[model samples]
Each structure stands twice: as C-alpha cells, then as structure tokens.
Target: MKAFVVTLVALAVLGPQIARAEGGFKVEPSMLTDWKTVYGQVEAKDSIPARARLGGTLVELSVTEGDLVEAGQELGRVVDAKIAFQINAIDAQIAALESQMANAERELTRGEELKSRGVITTQQLDALRTQAEVVSQQLEAQRASRQVTEQQATEGAVLAPVAGRVLEVPVAKGAVVMAGESIATIAGGGFFLRLSVPERFAGTMKEGDAISIDTAAGEISGKLAKIYPLIEGGRVNADVEVADLNSEFVGARVLVKLPLAARDAILVPAEMVKTHSGLDFVIVATAQGPMERAVVPGPMTKVNGQPMMEILSGLTGGEEVLAHEH
Candidate 1:
C-alpha cells in the first residue's frame, strides 16, 4: 500500500509535464506577410490659399502663421480708397438726379394745370411729361450704380477658403495685394500620411492592406487607403489613412512598414528555440528520442495571438519541437 501511495504522488506531480512534452507543436508551413520599411510624410488632403477678392491695401490682419481658422472665416480686411471714392461719387450723382426729378415733376404738374385752363396746348403738356420720364430713368440708373459700388467695397475683406491651420501669410498690414493674390496658405481637409514607395512594389501594393506606423509615442496601425497610378521619378505614391494620426506638425516624416507581399514559412513558439554558447538550437522529438538540433532563427512574429519565431534553416515540415523548459 505504501509503494502504491508513493507511485500515485509521483504520477500526480509528473502527469501534466508528460502531457505537455507529448503534445509538442507540430511544424507546418504558414503564410506570412512580407513588409517593406519606408518613410512617409504627414500631409493635409487640401492645401488652399485664402485670396483677396479685390485689389486693395491690407488694412487689418486677424491671423498669423500657425493659427487655426475656419471655412469662410474672415482673416483680414483690405481697403481700396478708390472704392470709397467711387461710392461717394455715385451718391452725389444720385442726389443730383433726385433734385432734377423733383423739378421735372413740378414742371409737368404746372403744364397740366395750364392745359386745363387752356393756357397751354396738349402738345406742350405731352413734351413736359416726356421730360419728366427721362429724369426718373436717370435717377434709377444712378441708384443702381451706387449699389454696385457698395458691393465692391464689401468684398475688400479676405475670407478663408477652407477650415484648417494657417501655414503661410505672404502679406502684412498695409501691404498691397491683387484681387487674386493669396493672403494666407491654409492646410485643411484633415491629415493623412503620404508615402513614396519603390516602383518595383507597385504590382504588389494594393488598397485596404494593413500598414504599421512608428510614431514617437508608439506603434500604430493604419490602412492603405489609396494608390496613385502615376509613377514619378521611379517612385509610386500612396496614401495611408489612420485614425488618431498626429497632425501637430505638417510635412513631418514618419517611419512606416507596408505589407508588400506574402510568403509561406515555418514558425514555432519563440521559447522553443533556445540559445547555447552563441548558437541557437531546438529540441526536436523523434523516433530516437529528443535531440538538440542547431537552427537559424529569423524575425519574431505572432501566430494565433501567441508570440512566435520564424525558423530560417535547420527545421523541416512534420517536425515537432519540445516545449521549452522553464
């Protein structure tokens, strides 16, 4: 009975160990994505300029470089002395026309009375009415001219074309600018990473592939959003879309890893490969019992959410590696 009790205790302690050793991972070829490291720049989707609507002097500037602005927001004011002068001239003409119109109506009224009294002929009264109509038309024309001048004056204020940060301000207060001159350069439409990849990978690159970004904070994942058809200077342009992308600095360079192709390789748990005397080895279970076989280990990878290491050489399919000892 004592012997049987001791045997039961030993079995209880070694049962789990024996099971793990017998259930070693079987090596098989699996697909792995090959990545290509490249540099990419943080770029805004749109870089537009806030332009002046009319030629004038920049009277007031409300924003500077690196300031955030909104679409259609007023960034500066321009003043054209000529525009104000034209408005004043139009007003004067309108006033003169009004006085003339009043005089013509009075003359027409007097002519009507004179005709009723038979003091004036009907032809004379008709001529007076025609004169009054001409004065009225002149007044209408002058009023319309005044409105046009006012509208031109209102357009002297420069407005932003898009919502974003101000990148460049080419003009200062009191500086002269043309109607289409840029007041400020704005970067807008959100931000994305623009990549220049080697032309040889064009055939393998595709949209919607997962991409890895190395930022100052940590590694973040992104998606390959677009691939341009044109190849410039033997480089293909691509765009990466990432949520929570850092846009603190425009034109900032970032390290990126893109999946260019896929290939089949053998992988095993990282712990399965042990290093001894500057050499790596793996314990392979075989008909002759466990044997330590020298192997070459490649980069580390993940398999089914577990950390794995790729076997570059000295391993074959259908081979089983023993569980790494603690």
Candidate 2:
C-alpha cells in the first residue's frame, strides 16, 4: 500500500510531462455542421419526349430503350399510306396541268403571230391571252398543293428533338400513333442529382452550398445548384451539381449528407479514444487518479489541422483527458 501511494504521487508529478510528450487534447465545445442523411437520385437535366409529327403507322423504329441518339436524327418513320396516295394524285394533277399550260402557251403564241399579221382581231388576241393566264395560274396553284403534300410526306419521319439516350420506347414498330403522340422519352442536357428533402429544412438549404455524396466509386462532393420554391407532399425539391458524376445509370439513388445547420459539439483527440469489446473508452485524469470511462464516439473530424473524434457522451468540457501512447 505504501509503494502504491508512492507510485501514484510519482505519476501525479510526471503527468504534465507525459501529456506533453504524448500530445494531449483539451475537451471543448466547437461548432460542427449538423448533417442530414438522405437519398438523392441521379437524373438527366432534361427529360423530353420524342413525339410523332404526323399521324400514321410507325413502320420503322431505329431505336429502343437505352439507345443513344442525336438531335434531329431519325428514330422512326411514320408512313401514312393515304399520304402516299395523295402525293401520287397530286403528281397526276400537276402533270395534267402542265399539259394544259403547254397547250395554252402554244395557242397564245399563234394568236400573237396572227395579230401581228392583222389576221386576228384585238378582242380575239385578248381572249387567247386570258386563257393562257388562267392556265398558268391553275398550274401554279396545283404546284403549291403538291408541295404541301410533299411536306406532309416529309413529316412522316420522326426525328429526335434532343441528343440523349432513349429512356422509353412506348410505340413499337407497326404501332399506329397520332400526331404529337410520344414515341420515346429521351434524357438529355447532361446529368445531375435531384433531391427531395423535408420541408423543415427548406430554410436551411441554400444555393451553392457544398454537398457530400456517397457513390459507388466512393464519397464525392457536389454543389447545391438549385432549390425550388414550391413545396409538395411536405418535401422541398433541390438539384445538386457534381463533376464527372457517373451518368451510366440514370435514376440511381445515392446516399447524401447535407449540412442543414451548425451546432456546438465536444471533441477530443482521436487517439485518446480506445475501442474494446465493441465499446469505446477514454482516460480522464482526476485528483484521485486516471479513470478509464466508457464513451460514445461519433464521426472523426479535424480541428486546427489535427485529427479529432467527437465525444457523443461520457465526457464534457473542462475535463482533462490523457492521450494514449502512439
């Protein structure tokens, strides 16, 4: 008992030197960001539907789901059999009008020759000119009508509105679709992360805030790009921009940690906390002696460029903790 008392006294005298040599940490409250863990979805910036311009049967489909396409690229062809028939009919009408126009021009030329020779009356020459003008106007009208029909035929080709991957192909080949009906849904304009957080955190969210994301490649940083004003279903929507984000799988959910607010927290040196039997412990020096107390440690952080561990419980401010040997 006497030797034990002497050993304790010696430790008390050398405690300061031991702490300085091993690197001691003071327990104090520091401000830390209060993070809220949530799931976010990888989404395309633009989700547009490729629609059919002309009502007809989809005769050819060049793309299906997960196919990449470019803007204005033909994805399918909508063939309206009636449109072809109409075009053929217009061609026939145009041919007939061209023949009539030729005949009218010949008669007008003959009339002019006769008038120059004083063989035809002025009234008769005027009649021939009038007939030729009527034929020319009719031909012009038929040509315009044919052009309109040809334009309708051109509309049968369904073109992609944007360059992106085809997400959904609603109509298959040989399926009849109406004008303005969606043929496939395309995702374009690059990729971003979409988040739906609780409305309670709306006021805390701000644009341009740094966000942490947990991805398959590991944790990555992102920025809070947008926050919507309208709230729905008690959730507030937001968009996060991440560089080099994996866009291979759109709509993939990823774990996210958002800094909602900041609060005071007690932190200690990470080396000071030791884990054993699935429970963490720290050494606290008191007048009696050094006592090993059970503690609940939170995530590791850094302070003043030094690694520190958050003490969730079993320690408080002004408590002297002994640093473990490295």
Candidate 3:
C-alpha cells in the first residue's frame, strides 16, 4: 500500500510537467507600431556665402551679424573712390573730345562747301573730313573707357544677393578683403534639418522622402530635399527641408526621423534580443527547452515610445522570449 501511495505521488508531480511540454508555450502576438531612424543637428536649407567680386578695403559695414537683409540691399561699401575718380576723369576727357569733334565737323562742313564752290582744293577738304572722323573715333573710345570705370565703381558697393538673415559677418570696417573671399554668410530662404545617416541606410534614401523633426521646443514636419552624392567617413549627409516649422525654430537644434515602408513581421523589444559575436538571436521557450533562434532584424520600430526590433526571419508568432540583460 505504501508503494502504491509513492507511485501516486510521483505521477501527480510529473503529470503537470508532461502536460506543459505537450502543449508547448503560449506567447502574445507582437504588436505592430510605427518606427523611424532619428538623427540630430543644426541645419538650414540654404546657406549663401557672400563674397566680394573686387578686392578693396572695406570702408563701411551697414549690417551686423544676424541682421535681416533683403535682396539687392547694400550690405557694405568698399573704398573704390579711386575708381570713381578715374570714371570722372574719363568723363572729362570724353567731354573734351566731344568738343573737339564738334569743332572738326564744323571745319569739315565749311571745307566741303568751299570745295563745291572751287574755293579750296579737294585735298584740303579731304584732310578736314579725315580729322573729323579721327575725332569721332577718339570720342567713342573715351566714352567706352568711362563706362568701364563707372561699372567698377558700381561693383564696389557690395549688395546682398538673397533675402535672409545674416549668419556671420567676418569682416569689419577698414578690413582688406580679396575677391571671392567670403565677407558674410546668410541662411537662405528655407529652413532645413541636417542629419547624417549610416551608409547602409542612406542607400535607400531618395530626394523628397518624408521625415519628421522633433526639437526640444516642438515638432515640425519636413521632407528630404537632397542627398549628398558622396559619402564621408562611412556616413551619408542629407538635408531635410522643414515644411511646417514656425519662426521659433530658427537656430534651434532638432532631431529628424525617417520612416520606412511597413512590412509583415514580428516585433519584440530590443531588450529581448541578444547578440553573440556577430550573430543576433533570441532565447525562446519551447516544448523541449529554451532554444536559441537566429533572427534577421530589420530597422527598429517604436512601440509605446520604446524601441521594438522587427524580426525579418526566424521565430514565429506566439513564442516566448527572454528579455536581454540590462
């Protein structure tokens, strides 16, 4: 009878274990949620470097750094008074030549009339006509020189090429500048979020791709404007122009997030996945025992604001998994 009691106790203890193994394990279906890759940086859609076309000493600076300016607005002036003086001298020379040409024309007309009346020889008339022609040519040449000098004087006044706030003013009054050297920088019309993406993911990026920007102050929506053709330091640089950003976003640092298309897949908390060497896997409870399954993880998605990794392959729905160590 004692032996029979022992058998009964052993069966009772083993029955539940056998039942659990036969039924396997039950797990909740992985929830589907939106996912994105994020990056942070200060960005502007357009940056214009204002440079000088002619080298000269800066005589005046009208705008300071961060000042708002309009297209064609005079930003500063270079000391080109010498050019203006040269223009004035050329104008004076042109005026003198014009007077000389008028005198020669009058003399030529008189000489032609005298020749027609047989009062002067054809050679004298011809000489007077030739003189008038020479004077006309000289006048034209002087006018052209005056025009060139005037153009140089006009170019001395540096103007803003586009309407925007000046980001930097690198030169001060009395500073000597060279042609093509940047005097100031302006942030052009639109705002953009600058982000660097990993080269692997950057290959998927295209112009006009949608993105979201989150700043400490607020969130704004934007689209990818352009992807730089070359990669630097194993990363790709891209610009996302903000479509709905307000005035407050000026000069603010923002985080940009890019979302990819959705696919049918299982998602688990990143903490629930483990990595050994270069292999990625998860520990799932099975009917036999705890089994390690290899998994191909796609881009991570967010669930309840937590990172959830998508399982591209391996493992099925309703399987138990162990959380990764902290």
TM-score of every model versus the real structure: 0.89, 0.83, 0.65
Candidate 1 residue 134 C-alpha distance from true site, Å: 1.9
How big is the positional error of residue 138 in model 1, measured in Å on the Cα after superposition? Answer: 1.6
Please provide, for model 3 over 1-326, each residue's C-alpha lDDT reduced to its tens digit, 9 standing for 90 to 100. 00000000112111111112232233333334333556656555567877877788898789887788898888888765577678778888988998999999899989988999999999999899999999999999998888887777677778888888888898898999887778788776766667788888776677886676776657666778888889999888888876666543356656677754433456666766788889998877667966788898877755445566767787566676654335
Residue 97 of model 3, lDDT score: 93
Q: How many pairs collide in each candidate, listed in order?
A: 0, 0, 0
Question: Runs in model 3 with CA error above 4 Å?
Answer: 1-37, 203-210, 246-252, 260-326
The ten-residue window of minimal lDDT in model 3 covers 1-10
Error of 1 at 283 (Å): 0.9
Please, what is the whole-model Cα lDDT of each candidate in the order they appear?
Answer: 0.84, 0.82, 0.70
- Identify the superior model by TM-score, candidate 2 or candidate 3: 2
Query: In model 2, where do residues sit more than 4 Å from their true spots?
Result: 1-23, 275-281, 284-307, 313-321
lDDT accuracy of residue 235 in candidate 2? 100
Q: What's model 3's overall lDDT? A: 0.70
lDDT of 1 by residue, 181-281 (tens): 99999999999999999899999988988889999999999989999999999999999998989988889999999888667677777877899899999
Whole-model alpha-carbon lDDT for candidate 2: 0.82
